[model samples]
Target: MEFRQDINGLRALAVLVVVLFHFGLAPVSGGFAGVDVFFVISGYLMTGIVFSRMEQGRFSLPDFWLARGRRILPALLAVCATLLLLGWFRLSPMDYKMLGKHALYSVTFLSNFIYQGESGYFDAASQDKWLLHTWSLSVEWQFYMLYPLWLLGARAVSRHPRAPVWAVWAAFAASLAASAVWTTRAPTQAYFQLAFRAWELLAGALVFLHAPRLQASPGQRSALALAGLAAIVCSCLHFTHDTPWPGMAALLPVGGAALVIAAARHGLWLTGNPVAQALGRWSYSIYLWHWPVWAALAYYGAHRQPAAIAAGIAASVVLGMLSFRLVEQPAARLLNRSGTRPRVALALSAACAAVLLPAGLVYVLHGVEQRLSPKVLAIAKEDGNRFKDRVACEFHPGAADPLPRCVLGDRKDVRLIVWGDSHASAVVTAVAEAVPHGVAYYGYQSCPTATGVHYRGWDNTCVAFNEAVLADMRALPPQAPVLIVNRFASYVFGKDAGNPEPVPGVVMDDEPQLSTRPELEAAYKRRLIGMLCRVRQTGREVFVLESLPEMTVYVPNHLARALLRGERPDDVKVSMADYRARNAVVGAWLQEARTTCGVRLLDPTPYLCADGWCGGSRRLQPLYFDTNHLSERGNRVLLPLFRQAFGGLGARKLAAQPAATGQGG
Candidate 1:
């Protein structure tokens, strides 16, 4: 396939926006759409190569695959190996372990699946992820691995030259439809999986298949190129991370790339300029190197600031250029040498094994904790001490309920029903120890205890669990007390910007993504109050938890790092006034609810915050299991609040009760 300068310029544009978006350097919230652009460009070139070779009656699948391997593997292996080396010194044990796993996945081209599985509100943030950007490369590699076989299948079905063309278009439509449907239903899978993403690439194939018929005057070509550039730029500038990605909205960037490629205006200023051409030439390496640089800076807590962002961009570009010069060029030359396929393949395979063996060893050793100081390692070990037993107690869309878990005390009488999201689960033991009654914990991930609100994910619905809990409450005898614990501020304002985008919530049974909606706090308050009043009407005591102060970092890992750096772990604290200001809207609603619904409030501030600060750690002991969920020790501090709230409640009934029937936690 001949190189088109316009296409190179387009590559330059695509990588540039993606870089800027990640670093947050430009007004390009939609810069993520740039990957869609690259996908289209990839499809065009791939299809052109395969079809042209087939036309010449000399196309070999192995040769084609080898070419792709040579083009991709050398630089990929270089980056993975580099990260593995530096990650040992730079990352925490858990983070390094994660890198090892991610590196393994990236090497195997299965990172998309692994990353999809790891997606959650509770997982590590993007900047904490070194190879997070590799998921796209994984997707592309999967596409490469499969697309030729699909073409071969199409060719096998028909002798006509146009068979694969028709087949690809059909597949393009199906992929697009799957992307649209799943973008709403299963966003994580839709966003990361090749099935949903293949259409964007196929759009490029269709453009290549039909480019011959797109004849136009040079002026018309220029206009079309400009329009395509505008569309791509608009998507970057207009859309945000919260946008349902790779849905129908992705067509803007995909189509724009296809149009620019189809226009074939090699000298157009937008794409064919000197800078664009240079960036284009180094695009793959630039894409590969930029993320780890950003991730490293992000891990150090300095990224997204002006100096850091500028330094990161400069570092990424320089590293990319060096990688191109030293690694990609040398590998290309070696592979292009006469009859070097076997040696090249063998060498690349050896390189992969070299990376895989250590990465696997690192993962097996759990990030090799022996390297850390004893104190930091102890802090690292505290991370997995979640308050609740996740396997049996936690509820997700399809999580198994093999036991009567979350029943913290005697099962004879479930005197108290503790309900909310995961935040509720975090403090269930504290409530259990404080009360004499059998505590039935009804905690679901992401499902806050509000009647008119719905959390978008969690396998599409949180309806059945909440409803069942409510029904159980109604069936209970009068004067049954219920405690609701939720981290309210997250849904309203979102976690600190670098964390996963805030949970997309449907408030008042209306629009989703509450943070974007108008008067969301007020709506959430109405729904919450209504639910509390309804419970009260059923002769149940409704106790709602005041907002738990959100943490700026993962407390355990932050403390461990502080220890590792010999910095004071106590320095990592949330401001007391800031916490109040952050939760002002929810606070107002809580005040109104106390009068309107007579709900009892249990404030954590009195127990957790003091001296104008809310400690993420308690005197070197970590309080949080993650950014927001409390560890067992962390929630134990709130025992006083729970005892006070449940102190005046009547004793449990001693009447014969239903047998505790399931497996125990």
Candidate 2:
């Protein structure tokens, strides 16, 4: 349980990388490895304490938990309470409501699981989370609850010989293998799951188990410390978000941290280093405090301001110092005092309950709207339904029911069956313009239009639903134009400059295999032709609508701000350059299809952004209602584009007159 100065330096290293990455600095793409470094260090320190005590025959569960509570709770409570109070005035209804749920989860040490169940860690949706970093703390706490007992059980089994070490190693190997498999099967789940993450901790545990030998000589120890430092630095600089994690990729940081800890006792360079020792002292507090500050800026949409961002980072450092002095030190002393720890723990737990109970109730009731704005409530309801709709579609909501969840647009003279997942669902309001009021809209949300491509994530119902759709398409009128569109970015496979290099795992149907731009273009061309051939067999003309442009910021939130400031909605659109660039790539691939297979590529660039200006929302109208999804108002603007692509439809004729104006006010 002795302090390791080198580990603190590692913490400084991890926090520095994470902060740099969050601030949008260049090429620290593998900066997320800081979390992995922390994970290994946590396991090492925590297991060290438990194993040391168990060997002394003095281990107690209550004492162990009290120590953890003292270590983690004070700062966490401070941040969550601060956020809750600030949310009262600063947050929008939806944002505030989301905070309430997070507050509840934070108190219960379940935020990671909650986030995993909702937005996976890499999702853009996760940025709005004020307590996203709390998930890691939760993961650690969950590990602590089970880890000590496992250690003790193994020790007991071997009659206190080498059983515990063997047990730890076995667990490490098993967990590592499990993590490797799960990383590819479900990367998000792999990132958050305790089972998958346990191996990272075990890597540290194994180091602690062999601590005596690792700390043998000063010369050897210095080398180990330097190697550990190098490994962590390399991980921070080279590892990225796309890196197949918790697999073999995580070994560098985990191993590095273990080496640092094992070498610190004998290494004069690390143990005597003033900066390393100082950072090590405040590392725990810094880790707890820094993320909430960064997350708060993200939640309030203030992360773009360089000055505000600098101030926020500085504030986090100040808070960490304060917590170390005023909270962590005092709480640790109190917990160490005989017979006082349990009572203090009970009181803190009670306080946590007091905060969480009301927050949970608020979330359950969906309190952000204050019930005055039914329109906002309606939109929230619709958004909630979209997730359910996605699930249902993936599970095959049936045609045998009284009324199908989705109906194909079969009644229109030119039946335009728009298809894809939620990306298509978002644009259905715009696509609906081509259909008469009574026409059927058949595509279900999350149900991809790909006929032969099998999805592995969902239930077997997806296969059946896909087969049914193909069968229905075979029977459709030949005059119908089937439009295939989905969020192709989700399926795109390549080295992500934004994340670390990905180690491709198991190959599945529809998984992208191309590594280069030329290879990707070729694959895209083949996929398009394959899709086109399938549609032609069904005797339908196919209109492949290339993906639409998206704004740099959250579209609805950004548009809302513009409207609030009285900007012209038509003048707020971003430059069409990026959108055009992406399409140019896709279009190049589609050219072969256009020449040989007669597939028409529809690009809405000119109409979506007329005369070099892509517009924003006005006081009278909203542009994008979601990140990339256009609003009803925004879709109305794009009606001209839709009309041009399909031919013979006007924006005026396509849009129904709004019942009133000044919405999103």
Q: Tell me, what's the RMSD of every candidate? A: 3.7, 6.8
- 279-381: candidate 1 lDDT, tens digit per residue: 9999999999999988778766788589989999999899989999999999888778736668767877888899999999889999999988787888887
What is the C-alpha local distance difference test score of each model?
Answer: 0.81, 0.64
Error of 1 at 233 (Å): 4.0
Model 2: how far residue 426 lies from native, Å? 2.7
Q: Which residue pairs clash in candidate 1?
A: none
Q: TM-scores of the models, in the given order?
A: 0.88, 0.79
lDDT of 2 by residue, 187-286 (tens): 7788888889999888888777787664356777788888887887788778776688867888888888778877874445544477656666776777
Q: Name the candidate that leads on lDDT.
A: 1
lDDT assessment of candidate 1: 0.81
Report the Cα lDDT for residue 315, model 2.
Answer: 81
